[model samples]
Target: MPKDALISTQSRHRMTTRIWHWSNALCLLILLMSGLTIFNAHPRLYWGEYGANDDHAWMAVGSSQTMGYLRLGELRIETTGALGNWQDSQGRTQTWAFPGWATIPSHYSLADGRRWHFFFAWIFSVGLALFMVMSLWNRHIQRDLHMRRDQWRPSHIWRSFRAHLDLRVIRQTAGEDYNSIQKMSYIGVIFLLLPLMIFSGLAMSPAMDANWPFLTDLFGGRQSARSLHFIGAFLLLLFFLVHMVMVLLSGPFRQTRSMITGGEGKEPLA
Candidate 1:
């Protein structure tokens, strides 16, 4: 085997990371779809301890007989034929906040949606926990993600940001080395957004409220926790959109192959 090829096979993603990456991806996707279905049950968000039809909500999606609209605070947007109301594959008009295609079961079933979301949520949580421990144990986080002292400089940071904006690949010592922006994005998603999604989800549960009242109180209230969970999920979706664009620009085949084989195309390193 060629020396460079050998290095490439051994140095990019670990077997554990690759496994977690795909499983976590699957988990998040289901959680998002089912969570959207659950959200359709109450397409409104509030900030206080409790929320209901009569209360003022920070955001809402509702449809009238002929039209659909999304209201955020005082501003209202007519979302007709898309959100608040949309047609399913069968051409039946749906009054749900999100259309059937975007949700699990592709129909209005809060109970089923909750089941799907919660089942995947557990898988997602366990995957994250294991990934965290493995990354640290393998020094993947420190070796690949942590910024050197020089990378902390404003000039390097600015350059990295611009290069990312231009969709330019910054090949450092090796092809697998992530730029500072990549590191930060990964860190934010891993340590902040994903965990927030999990905890806020727990905070909304009646069992958590009963067993650990402080968890609910930590987020101010149930309504606030729900709002935060929605926001976190949105941010995650945005992160994935940008991540896919970056991958496409950087060569999806090579990047995806690395994740798939994890550098051991024939015999994986033990």
Candidate 2:
């Protein structure tokens, strides 16, 4: 139906790319769930050098005897079943910001959550570092992700965004070279957001803070770094959700098969 759909399916994902894709996916899943467990320990966010129970929080998820709510500055909204308060698996009422099913241990245990978070965190960090080096060595970054001068123009970007919104481009290109918008999103996730998530996490560590004060200072403070880390994780989650939808919408079987086997269905174009 479309020109690119009829184009060659000769393009194959490299082994490193395929491995990194799935490994990164698993790492993010564990990190996010466990991170939620850790967040339930505080359930509040603040800016600047220090924050405490007595101090003002820019955002907080809390509950009263009768209600669970999310407070954002001066605004408050009830979130009884999902945030601030929810029932446990056994139907016992709990007052955690996130539900048990969404967290790692499915129970309140900051210690255990931290253990799970840190263990997978190392895997995520190491896997990301290796992916980057391999990507560079293979020139995958330069050849595949690099955008042409015309693709950077406002008109070109707008068209690409519109195509993504309508699912036109992805359905056509599928396993072919990524469109401009796709490349930019991948670039941001790979080079910027992932690194920020890692370094800001390190900035929140007490040992890193004491040994490398500059890391903490770079992000303003431990609390600020924590805030940034949460934000970065949120952005990553957003990307993952949208990426999944795109893959499923375009053709999940074809895409998944390519990533797993590192080969396309068709040998060459018509």
Candidate closest to the true structure, highest lDDT: 2
For every candidate, C-alpha RMSD to the true structure in Å: 4.0, 4.2
Task: Tell me how far candidate 1 lies from the true structure as C-alpha RMSD in angstroms.
Answer: 4.0
Candidate 2 segments exceeding 4 Å error: 1-11, 265-270
Quickly count the clashes in candidate 1: 0
TM-score of each: 0.91, 0.92
> Considering every candidate listed, which one attains the maximal TM-score?
2
For candidate 1, the lDDT comes to 0.85
| Tens-place lDDT digits, model 1, residues 1-270 | 544345335647778889999999999899999999999999999996899999999999989767899999999999999998787788877789998888997889999999999899889999999999988887778767787788888899898888876644432222556777788899899999999999999999999999999999999999999999999999999999988888777777877887887743423222
